[model samples]
Target chain A: MNAFIVIAVCIVFVYTVGFALSLWKQKNKIGAMAVLFLAVIALVLPYFSYFQS
Target chain B: MKQNEGKIGIRDYMAIILLTLGSKVSDDTPTLLYKTAKNSAWISMLGIALLSLIPILFLLKVFSVHRNKNLHEINLHLFGKVMGNLISMGVLLLGFSSFVLDTSVYVDIIGSMYFTRTPTLALYILMLVVCGYGAKRGIESIGSAAWLTLFYLKATLFLALIFAFTKGNLKFIFPLWGPGTLEIAKTTGSKLSIFADFYFLGIIAPLVSSFKEFRKGTLWAFAIVVVEITAALIIFVILFDFTSIEVISYPFHETILYLSIGFLSNVESMFLPFWLVAAFIRFSFYLYLVVTLFGGIFKIKEFEYLVPVFIVIVLFLGIMPKNLTYTLPYLREMILGILSPLFFILPILMWGMAKLRGDFKREAEQSH
Candidate 1:
């Protein structure tokens, strides 16, 4: 279960970065920056928090 | 009311208010009442309902005189440039904080009970995102969703009630007075935080058609929430008894957990969707209020874009607390101390200012 969640976190982080890059290329600064920022809190924090719980 | 292009009938308005009020019977309220009022928790509820009616009626009277002007517009009219905008901004902040507190409440139950392994912020984000989507859909859509889901919501409540009564003992809620008159009055004043949800009614007042519809819908919605909350408390007391609820944490969840309507072993599972949908309606209603508030405050003709920025702020606020233990009490204080006045006082102050200063007299004369 832990392994699966970790992998899920990695996938989400990767996808968000890719999405952010695409938006950045299109000059959508807010949308692009929000992706990476949200990933840190919403996507990554949950992984460590899972273990902490 | 100036920017509000949305029109909802009495039924839709009733549904929005009902869903907003009913879905809020989550664990926070009953537990707080149990801790405060003991066996006479319902008395505090009665006090809250009665006390709450004063603000609602006064705000309604203000709306009646203003006709089609919402709380924001009324504030602008009554208090003028600086004080009016300041007061409206306070209500706006309260609306944002309300959704944050509410989402955290839902996150508490979902994280501790169902998904022990899931991260709290993830759950918060998921709920907020879904709720934000619904909010972005606009008030008419939210109203329609509330209306659409009203039947299932009612059915779930009925099911929970049947299950609760079947296994509950009414002898538990006896003596008729938990903390007696004075203590209950104090608790009622403090517990008035629960009724702050109804403050949304003032924000959406003008979207409602006709004074008749507004009054009828508001009264009906108020009556429904009062009755429903009173019944929920009664059921909770019957099921959990007195002291058990104080230590148990989620009294309503625990009460409903005992329910098993033959074959439907975990009825809460079935009830979850109904709760989510109704809760989404409630969540989106506040979200809508905040966006409208920004439009009024910033003089922005286009607020559709700011919705996401505000949701980002909600996400930040919702996840700010580490957990429910640290979240509930301080939030209780803030809501009762700050947000309550913002929601309750600002509108009343607007009304009082209008009356004292005769600010709206010119508009009234011109309209006639």
Candidate 2:
């Protein structure tokens, strides 16, 4: 659904920016981990879309 | 004492007030108020504000007596170790439980509204990790971050409300006071949850630079509440009339969704990031306070060690409520029946005890 796309994109975008800011603050480990974790979710989230009513 | 080491300055205290007030005036409050007071939710907010003064005055009296000591130290002084520790543990439990419930509700709102497909557990983990990171940074970081978050939150909310006003309907808010006096009382009592967490201010009081500045900060904080309540009133009157708002889980979010500016549609999405940031800051600050309170009470040297344990507790509490219907009503009742008394009564009792024992003078002399 359109709701799913909008949310996914928004979450990714916001988290990416937040992670970048964390990196700038020298929280590199946290920043890197956040991106990697969310990236994996972003990839996998689409597969579950078939279950949506 | 070193400049940064002793106590926080006026700016920091101001930041705390803003942060505290901002955290409470989120997506949840308006809906809760509407449900309780019907069309006169704004009136109930004003009533609650008046009622809240009883507690605030008590807290101020306590701080006036104790001067610079935090809540934990004062408790230890008054009740000694065992009873003080027990009371401190009670406060900790109340704070932590409330924070967990709040954070979960926030996550659920986001998940339900936006990411319907994503598991609630995923959202919970994400929020907890971020909260833990912020908590690890300590009070100073939280204060400064609060300053920034408050700025964005105010700006975005103001803009949204202003934009929504252009498409306004004055007719929606007819017959301001709803059915009867008992209904108004019930609604006002139910919405006391918004002010329940003001108890945390006692613990943070020592960090404030001066009583004069803290008083000024409290005034500013109250002004923010006025603004929040007015905005909610405006939105309710304009968008939902009265009956419809009472039924919605988050009437404010729904109001934002109805907002449109020419080519731009569904601007609530733009507001979502700000909402998330605000929620994270609020939840994390409360969690940090809970941990700090536990550490201080138990005489633990390093509070950071308890972060994981608290996180696990929050996770359990967050998931325990099966759905919003169950969770919200329970929260409302709990705040009014249990939390409100502690929030209002404890500070007064502490202040009285401190005065009666002459501990205040002794503590002041010792500190000097």
How large is the i-RMS for each model, in angstroms? 7.3, 11.6
**Candidate 1 ranges with C-alpha deviation above 4 Å:** A1-53, B1-4, B341-344, B359-368
Candidate 2, TM-score vs. the true structure? 0.80
Native A-B interface contacts kept, per candidate: 0.00, 0.00
Q: Per-residue lDDT tens digits of candidate 2, residues B197-314?
A: 6677667777777877776777677677666766657666576677777677766677677888678897888888887877777777787788678657644435554555456446
Candidate 1 residue lDDT tens string, B90-187:
77766667667777777888888777799776777677778778777777888888999998998888778778977988899887897677777777
Clashing pairs in 1: none
Q: Pick the candidate with the highest TM-score.
A: 1
The per-residue C-alpha lDDT of model 1 at residue B33 equals: 75
